[model samples]
Target: MTDAIKANIEKILQDSHVGPMATVQNDKPHSRYMTFFQENLKLYTATSKETHKTEEVEKNPFTHILLGYEGDGFGDEYVEYEGKVTISNSDELKKQLWIEDMKHYFDGPEDPNFIVLEIEPIQIRLMNKKGKAPKVLEL
Candidate 1:
């Protein structure tokens, strides 16, 4: 990817917004809203081990995530991520990504059931109204 394109992608990733995450379950697609956190190109989300989403990821590591579109009706800019997810139970990482608001779902950063889904993007497409074609970003 060009430097300008890379910068744009990073901006979208850092916008502090939630996005739709799609995972496969029983050979069908299941999607839900999920809060996103990123480190460079890698994305992370918090979830409970008991949740069906976790189980789905465990069974099928491949996932699709849509980010950056916020329904403004003006901009069509967004990103589609194809990635492999790793379920993590590292205390240090959980603590680092933890926030006060997460207590609503997770007991705490150290909650045994609390886990992090780390998405390693294998392919990313940057899409927008400005471009006639979607730009594929190199992972």
Candidate 2:
């Protein structure tokens, strides 16, 4: 990828706070909005172990994520992520990614039901009207 594209990708990853996470359930696509956090290219999201989404992920590890689009206008930039997810129960990771707002769903970072969904992207496509072709990022 060119430096400009790389920079734009990083900016989107850093600036966007929410995204749609899609998972398959009963042969149908299920999607929902989620708050996202990233460590470099790796994506992380918090969830309760009791949720249906968590159960769906346990059955199928693959996921699709849509991020960066703010609905400002046509031609807005966005990223589509194809990845495999693994559930993390690590206390340290939970603590590291925890925020005050998370208390609403989780008792605290130590809440047993609290878990982190780690997404390792196999392919990421950076797309917008400016580019003639979508920038396929290296994993």
Candidate 3:
């Protein structure tokens, strides 16, 4: 990614904590709010192993995520990610990324029902203001 694009991405990630993850299920679009953390140029989020989101992704790995920071006067600043989601139970990744609030979702790295949703972006589009469409930036 270019410095400009990378900066834009980091800005969006830092400004927004929640995003809607869009995935296709049975040929239809499904979306849900998800809290995410970005690391090593990949996106990570935790989910219960028994959720429908987990089952849906297992059938189809493709997904789109949009996160933003809204301003009262200025247009909403946001970034959209087009990526593939990989679900796994890697202890090292969990430990490395764990934050305090994650304890509510998982007992620990060893939580049986906890799993990480890793998103690898193929492309990213960012729009920081109005009168402009999202500009595609490489991942």
Candidate 4:
């Protein structure tokens, strides 16, 4: 990866704690804000298995993630990721990604309704600042 892209990627991962995840439901787009963590260069978000998002992903694995943050005198930088979602039941993954603060949402990593949204980015488009064309990278 180019240094600029790599730097932007790290800035995104460090600056933002949540992103909007978009999924398709009933042939329409649905989006929701979610807190995410990163592992192995992939983004992870956990949701209830019974939620609409879980059902949507089961039918269509494609998802889009938008993460952004305002920078110090650098305007805003945003990253868009196109990825395939995988329904994960891996206990180890949950354990690894678990945060104490997140327990309020999940009861625990072992909660029956809990499921992981593993987004493996296939393509990334990053806009470093206002009025600049995005830099696109294939993952």
Candidate 4 structure quality by residue, lDDT tens digits, 1-139: 5777867776786677688899998999999999887754488898889899999999999998888755454657888878889989899988887778867778888988888889888887887667678888645
lDDT per residue for candidate 2 within 1-139, as digits (tens), equals 4667767777898899799999999989999999989877789999999998899999999999988998877689998888899999999999999999998999899999999999998888898846567898876
Ranking by lDDT: 2, 1, 3, 4
lDDT of 3 by residue, 94-124 (tens): 7876777878777887788888999998988
State the lDDT at 93 in candidate 1. 94
CA lDDT of every candidate: 0.89, 0.89, 0.83, 0.82
TM-score of each: 0.94, 0.94, 0.87, 0.88
> Which residues of candidate 1, in runs, are more than 4 Å off?
none
In order, what is each prediction's RMSD in angstroms? 1.3, 1.3, 2.0, 2.2
Q: Model 1 scores what on Cα lDDT?
A: 0.89
RMSD of 2: 1.3
